[model samples]
Target: MPKFAETIFQIMKKFFLSTTVLAIIACLLWATPFTAIKIGLKYTTPLQFAGLRFFLSGLIILPFIKDFRVKVKEASKRWRFVLWVALLQTTFLYGLFYTGISYVPGALGAMLIGAQPLFAAIMAHIMLRNDKMSWQKVFAILLGLSGVCIISLGRADFVFTTTIPIGVGILLLNNIVGSTGNVIVSRDAKNMPPRVLASFSMIIGGAMLLLFSIPIEHPNWTAVHPGEYYISLGWLAMVSALAITIWFGLLGREGVKVSNLNTWKFIIPIFGACLSWLVLPNENPDTISLIGMFVIACSLLLVNFLNRRAQKAQVRLSSMASH
Candidate 1:
């Protein structure tokens, strides 16, 4: 029995490397937003909820702003660039995201959100010379996206509606625009600290969202229970801060392609479904959703495996040349 237990432990340990483990944790954390959004929307309108979440997320990073200011001074004229980043990354990204989430189930929202990496791959290829797309990468991206389609179409509740398409389209647009922002930031390669960029961009974007929500939503504060409000905001803000920080940090990691980093985002929907099942009442996934999740996970594993093989081959070629 002891030997069997030891073998099981070793098998589990071999399955998850440190980076893969970290990525899974990050994906799980990131998956919370859809559920959180569902909870928060019980108290506030979508735009207002998004505004508050991102505003607080930005505020959480304020203690580190002194370095951001110094970086801004050196790159003074880039405030416009920063604003553009804020517009795409925060303002439109969550503006549309929150709005879209309202229309779809959390599980469906997760599937749509998982499509971001596909958009990111296309944007990265166009924007970064070094991150050119390969046939394998292209095929991997399609496989991942096909899983999203299966999830969407295979569900029994699926139906075509004007509102449903609009919601899905907005989410897709959010991914495209958000991916564009990522490529821009990567192309800049300013080596700006991720926390600082996150701080300023989120603040700017959140303010814009709040401004829009004021005229449109006029969200009533008295309607929200203080405990639930604080809890939702706290979770959303913390996850947003951490996810963005980790995402940008990974993007800046040497030899890590943005598309490669994003392919792991496929796990977000899988974890999202599991968590929603556990946390949100009436959110248990069905057979189709489970099958779709399996497809996406397999695609991610395949992409990463191919990437590692390619990287190893490149290293070998470099070593041969040096010798």
Candidate 2:
């Protein structure tokens, strides 16, 4: 190989192996699934599709888990906690998510879901005594909310017949439910194995969705789907499995700060929206929507910055006290 080519290859190898790069890759995987979900929903009802996707994701993770039966038994001890997480995180959240995404543009759905970290911060503040909100967090939340409002306004036609408003509202509610589930896990599931928690929650929650769909959606299970539908479903399931597994691995790595890793998630909306515009024929970029996305991105960055600063300040104070 030429010296220049060799040097570029070495750089790329190192970049691909780094934790930061892996985190970004996980975010990218997460971003792609919105477009896939939109495609899959075309062939089946929202809940039915989401159920199969998550159930498959759970099964995919099972083989990788060491001593799966033992871990499951341990998880069963906290079955209530696990069930709550399943209901809130996977079932209710994704149930609303699929329904909401069905009605909205894929870019809008991605942007709304990407705003979850802001809601998560609020949930943490409310639920954890140590995570009380500061002025910076308050400001970040307000800015994020404004961005959400802008994005909604940009998409709305102000007509009663349009489902855009309803879709946006459901997605916003989806974020709240998701944030609540995060807080519950953070506060209570400290001792549980992460993989086990994820696996069971997805499996159980997905089953609930499937059962619920029978009565509510009345889906035609016998109907055959095109190759495109199966392709979308497979991609979505793989994305969920890989993204969650990768994220959990990153969290376990030494010296990898959760806040820093989480910062990469800010790019999810940016990438997701761009991908939707690129891949989906009906979706296109608008100036207002772009502006809204930029605002939301800035808000997430501001919040993550403030959080890291606060963590550093606390570390310094603890050092001083110890000395």
Best by TM-score: 1
Candidate 2 per-residue C-alpha lDDT over 153-246 given as tens digits, one digit per residue, 9 for 90 to 100: 6755434338888999999999899878766766676677667877888889989999999999999999999998999998988888888666
After superposition, the stretches of candidate 2 with alpha carbons farther than 4 Å from their true spots are 1-23, 101-115, 144-169, 246-266, 277-297
C-alpha lDDT of residue 237 in model 2: 82
Kindly provide the TM-score of model 2 when superposed on the true structure, using C-alpha atoms: 0.79
Clash pairs detected, candidate 1: none
